[model samples]
Target: MNAILLILIMIAMGAIIGGATNSLAIKMLFRPYQAVYIKNWRVPFTPGLIPKRRKDMAEQMGRMVVDHLLTPEGMQEKFNERGFQKQVIQILQREAKGWMHSKRSVADLLKQYAGVTDARGKMTAYSEEWIDKKLQMFIYHNQEKSIDEMLPPEWKISAESYFDSFAARIADKGARYFESDAGRVQLETLLEKFLQGKGSVFNFLSSMFGNDKILDKLQPELVRFFRDPSSAMFFKGFIIKEWEKLLDQPVWKAGAQLNTKSVARYSVKALNRELTVLDRLDMPIAEWAPSYEEHIINKWIPELWDQVQPALSAKLLSVFDYLELEDVIRERVDTFSVGRLEAMVLAISGKEFKMITYLGALLGGFIGAFQGLFALFFS
Candidate 1:
């Protein structure tokens, strides 16, 4: 009985010591968050293991996250997942639906979202400036080139045909004019002027014939000359000579004749007037694009997603590199307070830690039982 009592006491003592030691050890893992020192002699294990190695742990965790958990391949896989793609498409469709049905005018949206004060005025100014810049660039680049060089190849190829048509029209109009009463009166007046310019002998001959008679003869001849096909050739030759002279002049001379600022302003105005959509800037989007839900939401969105998904998947690695996610995780983990970190760890494994302490007590009690039996056997 006494032996039995001694064994029980030994087991109890062993159990107590083991449990207490383990509990203390567990507490020490997080307690004494800061280093403890006595007059420059630092106490061993002054700070907890977690606290001491927090930075290194943080760095390891960051590497682990980047290397294993949040790898580019993993991210790309997630992006390619059908469920994720569907979710993204659904979200986009919802946004499109909202905007499509919105009663807000484009001007209002621009003012609200983009901080634009006057959408029309701003667009007009921007267009005018763009046009002016383009015109200036064109003038500067082609200033040294003659108009003939500046003209398109197609225009040069068809130049003769255009000249022929113009000359034929001019001859026909001239012949008609000369056959009219107006042409006869004009001819008589011209004859009078010519006879007056000539000597008295020509003047006497003109008087003998009379201005009316002279004009009657000359007017018919003028009409016939204009009616002749060669007359058209004559006008065409004259026009070709003038056109050649004009084409020989440099582009800068032609540009100098234009009012570029006025041209830009008028061009912008004409564009604004002609582009019927600009007039509807103040109208609600729903009113103008009633089929937006049908076209943009149903058809366009899916097509756009299909095109973008592959490209985005391919670029996930680049995106992750740009983000430097490992450093981000490391910084975040390092910045956590020791107490907070301890609490987090405890929250995850508190039950397991208690079981460890209990196991230590059981193992110590078993060893104590064996020692007590040995001592008893020896006695």
Candidate 2:
């Protein structure tokens, strides 16, 4: 009778105390996250020791993550890690081959990959249209920081180079138009009109391209021509020369408006297109040299930067929010993360949380053993 009674009591005590301890320990981790302020004297370990310390912990974790698991440089180091990306590409190639060998046009696969609705549907958003909200945000939010940090920052490198590049581009453009028949004609018209009237020549070309006035007979050919890098480079050079001459004009020296407003507006439009081009290529902007980047950022990025910052920050935060491991673990306590799963039997960090069962059994066994021993020896 004593043995039976003692066994039941031991089991009850162990069940209650063990559960209490585990709960208390875990609770302590998150409880005191915010510091307590009383009489301007702070309490020791004011709140969640585990999570309250998490700011520093998070910073360290951030650094560690940047260093080991997901650092930009580290990721690049493992670019072909386990050949996963390569294997994916190879699988795609094989699948493509299989599809080719079969009856389907790869167009069907491309449509699926491209998120086309179906064979009957056209793309709602192509490379040019898709926002890549992440990259957009990065470019938008970091515009000022990007300029301050990326530009040479020297008076010559930063300010002078900026204007000089602008002038150089404009002058280079002037050379093209002033020299080329198409460009010379525009300039000749402009000079003649300035000598007498206002934009008597460009007035026609401008009016013709206006949406309601002229159906863009040139739209298809223009889109195709603009897609060529060499063509763009040549025209860009031509425009730059003309721009340089405008900046150097004696009328401006006498304090005429340098017409900076127009230049800035034009730059923003050009950069918007350049960013679209880079997106289509799926190229990283960081790959460009500083000087080359100066041309892009300095010349083209100002107008859209302010509009895009908030959008970018929100998108970046969204991606990070999705990657939060703690939330995932708590939400699905039985599950482990992809990292933990990949490490699998190596860490024995499987989903079973065998520890729950193991701990319960071990503690129960000890409690039972103590009760049995006490009943045998003392009771």
Candidate 3:
């Protein structure tokens, strides 16, 4: 009876020690959330394994996530998948369909999306500003350049070719003006003035010949002079000289007379009138572009996806590099409280951990049993 009681006592003690040690070991994995210090010395294993190695664990986690889970190849593969593409397309189509039936005007849409209150006014202002800026830039760039240098070679050639015709037209017009009754009257007055300017003898001759006869002769002579080729050549030379003077002047000199603000405003107005689409800004988009949905679904979405998916896949590596995803994961893990980390780990592998604890207990019990048997054998 004493031997049997001894054996029973040994077995019970072994089981209790085994179970308690195992439970304590399991608890030690996460107990005492912070390090414990006694006077000048620090207690060993006070903050637990996880808390002590949190930084290294976080780093490892980050590297593991980046290297294995969120690899560029894996992302590219997912992006290229037909399922992802189809989902994106379907989402875009649904949004487009909603927009197509919307009663909101373009201006309203602009207001909602871009915070633009007056779309037309804003566009006009922007256009005017753009025009003004461009004009200013042009003036700044060409202010020192002479018109001759600024003019295109082809334009210079064309202008030179037309000079003769221009001069001929001017001469023809001058002759016709002189042939009119008004021209005759002006000729008579000029002759009288000339006689008066001369001495009384010339005046008496002019009166004796009669002003009418003098004018008739003067008019024919004037017409003949204008018809003469030399007259046309003279006008052409005059025109060429004037043109050369103009061409020699710088662009700033030419533009000095212009009102740029007024020009920009007028240009904007003309553009607004010519672009009839601007008028549709106040009208509902559905009214103007009813086929938008069909086009978006059939053409735009597919084309956009086709272009964007490959680009995204190609850029996935660059994006991942820029994001430093591993560092992000590591930082997140580091920030997590020990208790929270423990809870999460337990949640994932709680059953396995329990089994490990039980295994440890079983092993401990086996060891205790062997020790007990050895003591008995020695006795």
Candidate 4:
């Protein structure tokens, strides 16, 4: 009975020792968050394993996140997901709808970023200054590209057409005038004045040669020529031919002849007229802005997003570099305290560690039983 009791005591001691050892090992992983020092010497297993290697672990985690977990490829795949894109578009549409309906003035929306306010600390009406500045920059950049280069040749109205139209109108008016008796009399008087304006010698020659009679007779012929449709057509064709000759000259030479300052002044005046009409609105901006915004949302956004999808990989790489992704990951990991780290580990594998401790105790009990049997047999 005593021997049996001794064996039980040994088994219990072994089991307790094994369980305590396993528990201590588990505790060692997280205890003593800082290094323990004894004067000039350092204590064994002073700092916990996790605390000792915290920096290395953080760096490894950062690399893992950048390389294997949050890689460019993985991010691009997420961006390409149709469901994800649809969700994003839906969110944008909602926000845009809210913004469009909001009572906030255009200035109110922009004042946060631009800070263009009045003396009362209230947002002022939208200013054309920024628009003017941007437009000037655009014009400066495009100065080298002539207007003709921007417009296709087919879009230009032919010079012949304008000339033909002008000539036809003039000929029609002249025909109407010559068809009247007043026009015939005016022509006779003009010819008479011309003949009399010459010296008396010329008038004597005109009388001797019947030039005065010839001039009186020529009036009806002149009237017929002006009224005739064939003559009218000829004059129109002549004007168009002259216009074509002008058009055939180099465009640059024609442009050089024009006063660019006058052109710019007139263009700006016309644009300002239209813009002023828009500014003094009969209807609310909200009514018209939706149509424009809807156009952008429905047509432009899809096209823009399509373009962005193809370039996402390169853009993601650039963004990651700009964001300092590795350092960000490292910094976030380093911010975790030792207690937080222990909690995170325990959350992951607490049950497994508990099982390890129990297994240690079971193994120790079996070994002690065997030792008891050996002692009983050898004795």
Each model's lDDT: 0.88, 0.48, 0.86, 0.71
- State in Å the error of residue 4, model 2: 1.0
Distance (Å) between predicted and true CA of 221, model 1?
Answer: 22
Model 4 RMSD to the real structure?
8.8
Report the error of model 2 at residue 256, Å: 29
lDDT of 3 at 164: 93
Query: How high is each candidate's TM-score?
Result: 0.62, 0.29, 0.57, 0.60
Clashing pairs in 1: none
- What lDDT, from 0 to 1, does candidate 1 have? 0.88
Candidate 2 lDDT at 212 equals: 24
lDDT of 1 by residue, 1-379 (tens): 9999889888888888888889899988877999999989989997988899999999999999999999999989899899999999999999988887789989999999999988977877888898988988898899999999988888877886799989999999999998998877787777777787688899888779887787778888998998899999999999999998988989899889877888999997787678655666788988867665788888999999999999999999899999999999999999999999988988999999999899889977987888888889999
Task: Judge candidate 3 against the unseen true structure and give its global Cα lDDT, from 0 to 1.
Answer: 0.86
**Residue 349 displacement in candidate 1 (angstroms):** 3.3
lDDT of 3 by residue, 1-379 (tens): 7666666667767777877877787778888888899997889988888888899999999999888888999988888889998998889888887777789988998999989998988888888899988887887899999989989999999999999999999889889989999888888778777788698888788879988887878898899889999999999999999999999999898878677778999998887788656787888888867655667778988999899889889999999999989889999999999999999999998998778767766776677677777778799
Per-prediction tally of clashes = 0, 21, 0, 0
Candidate 4 — worst ten consecutive residues by lDDT sum?
119-128
Listing every candidate in turn, what is its Cα RMSD in Å to the true structure after a full C-alpha superposition? 7.3, 21.5, 9.1, 8.8
Answer with 1 or 2, whichever has the higher lDDT.
1
Of candidates 3 and 2, the better by TM-score: 3
